[model samples]
Target: MRRSVISGLSAALVLTSAGVGGALLAPAASAAPASPALTTGVADGTYVSLKPTRMLDTRGSYLGRPLNAGEVYNLKVNGRGGVPSTGVSAVVLNMTVTAPTRAGNIVVYPKGSAVPNASSLNFVAKDTRANLVTVPVSSDGWVSIRNATGQTHVIADVQGYYVGSTTTKPAGAVDYFPDDPWRALDTRTAQDGPALAANDYLIQSVSYGANTANISALAVNVTAVNPQWTGFLNAWNGDENAIPNTSNLNFASRKTTSNMVIVPVTHGVGSDGTTPVLNFGIGNASPGTVDVIVDVVGVYATGDGLRFRSVGAPKRIVDTRTSLGATTLDAATTRTVTAPSTVTNSTTVALVTNATAVSPTAATYLTLWQTGVTRSAASNLNPAAGQTVANMAMVGLSDINQFDIYNNAGRTNVIVDVAGRMDLSPNLASGAAPSLSTRTAPKALGSRVATLR
Candidate 1:
């Protein structure tokens, strides 16, 4: 039997003065010099907040000219947010690309490389869109953003950074685990069944037994559907009272939209001690109600089996649109896609691909899973009739070094760009076993539910 990808919030606008300004702090004297090979894992999920600093703008003479089509802009990431240039691995940012003269997408990757065929944001001509992006910084502390269409303006606001070491350790001693996409919270049928009221908030606990053990953060895809009014969604640690001006994603009233977020989990736990729970506060930033769906794509823990590695740039790995010697995938059909040997190794567990569907004849969603395995109940990308839609999918690979992609609706041409991969090797040399005494695996919730109120 094929595995099914099971299908699966908003609150108020209390304007808290969370300023987006900050001075670049000098690197800590005691801090180790940054290393290109070092990949440090955050066990306690410690993230230092930096004032949302603007790093780039292509409009209004910030760059002296609007970004031209196919142009790449390099932005320095080191020394921002108190992160020194030498030791940083990844940075958390709120990136907004706007004012495009024509419809196109942007791809963000490390500097000094070819632009990956992947896309970070897709916009209509002259429309602005923002999304939370966690991108890897190159050893030189720079990242590159490529504009794929007409001239446009780009904005990046720094929030935090992750530091890692270069040594080797046991497989499961990393900071994040990229799980097969799992639906954890669905507000439509939750106790708060229905929609999140305007200016209201939803506090949801994300705990999935064993999988969430020692989890300090979660990499989730939050989707807002059937919003009653035009608004945005703000997600943060539920225990905090102040809501940052940062938004996960914006949506028009009655439209469905999704964005990726990497939020720190709360420190509370159940009696078993292993069931650590993270309080996710979802705030509705519009005047009406909206329903939210939360899906866990990965978790950051102190110990782990796989660590993330950012590629030099995103590359086109699969394009059923004829780029990779493939044909359009028909409705209700599954196609197996393989990564290049240069990209996949013995320890490779997953590949991050931006899957886009174009010219669809009907409404449908895409499901991806390891090859030879039943299709997961999770959907990776959704497309509407005669429209082009894209979403990032982190697909786990089976031993066969291939994964399956399934389209549930009309035949559509699919395009996939490989951005990065998660592998089983640790960055550092063998280290002491991570102390798991205080950590317990997540406890299963018979029916994953979210409290609506």
Candidate 2:
């Protein structure tokens, strides 16, 4: 007897070749269709802080001299506990560019490619700044950090990485679905409901069972506001033991700050026969209460859909500061911006860009989404008066190859830098697949086997 599996989407198991009377088994479907990606509206955890370790510093003699102005450096990010040396799709790095001899910005992306015309960490001369950056590793296994405008030293600490197949899937085998950034949790005034006291941890669930099954992780913007004292915050999987030496965001007392975070999650039943959940933990390391908020932008999962492609460097896609020679976006104004056709089209579903808000008259935020859709009750970049702030935004696209940008408060200058894009096409040019291994003996149906192959 022959067994065949079929799906409503016209997917089937077919026999390719057989020897004599023997039946042949064809290759399995590359991957299953993924769920439509969207940002979840829920509170996943309260803010907690962890101590951070320095992983790399280009300024010190260890890695040689500081990065020359307008130069790029290739950095390795693997061999950690969460981010294995192999099977890593993308890495979550807390990057800081410091000691700039002149005013400029730093652009981080996949290595060995042209630097995209974008900035990741902006700074004035001698000022130090840090941002949580999620960068896909190049096929050759490194990320590029470029210094734009002036010479500067770069520092990066490993937080985590997105993992993919241990068997046949290549690095960056995961697909991304971007949601209109939505506020999933806000402790201030109990927006999404849970509040936390000092030194407490809260578990949050995002897209566990309702929208899609088998979600391995999420990409989110975590914000901390109104803390009683200076402290840091940690975001991690609820089911795993806390990694005590890492912090996601560091904030001053009574201030509002946000950082992008990539958190791994548990799915389905474990080997112990207990159901698992996509849980996140927020630990408050401050001495007093602090409100926490999360805005989900995207998710990472294995599927027969779009996967990420690094453009080698960050590219400046839109700059509203000079749009039609207009320097500022007036309050309550909405602008339709067409993404360059080179970056998006019918096959591209989402884009990853660094959205910056600078010199606003009043506290303002920027909302980004596909053109023609109802504006989501979410924002991508929020900047305070007289301050320049940038946050990475993962935006979805429609057939129009356009997205809308709306300013929620007083006038502000906006800058959009493209880091990469996600498309439905697979990288068929990646060369030959690794050889496969076979089992010599039959195994029991319910039995478990452990082998490297």
In lDDT terms, which candidate is top?
A: 1
TM-score to native of every candidate shown: 0.75, 0.69
lDDT of 1 at 252: 69
lDDT over C-alpha atoms for residue 417 of model 1? 70
Q: Assess each prediction's global lDDT (C-alpha) against the native.
A: 0.61, 0.57
Give the residue spans of candidate 2 off by over 4 A: 1-54, 57-73, 78-92, 97-104, 110-116, 123-129, 134-139, 147-154, 159-167, 170-173, 180-182, 189-195, 210-213, 267-276, 324-327, 425-453
Cα deviation at 349, candidate 1, in Å, is 0.7
TM-score between candidate 2 and the true structure? 0.69
Model 1 Cα lDDT, one tens digit per residue, 1-453: 101111100011111111122122111111211222335533222233343455665654456566777777777878765555555666667677666799888778777665655676777776656666657777778887777778788877676665545343322233545555667667777354557778777666765444444555667777887889877786766654455655666776666777666766565666466555666667777888888877777665553334556655667777777758256888899888777876677666677666777777987877777776556566766555775666666677766567888989898888777666666534322321111111223322222223222
**What would the C-alpha RMSD of candidate 1 be, to one decimal place?**
10.1
lDDT of candidate 1 vs native?
0.61
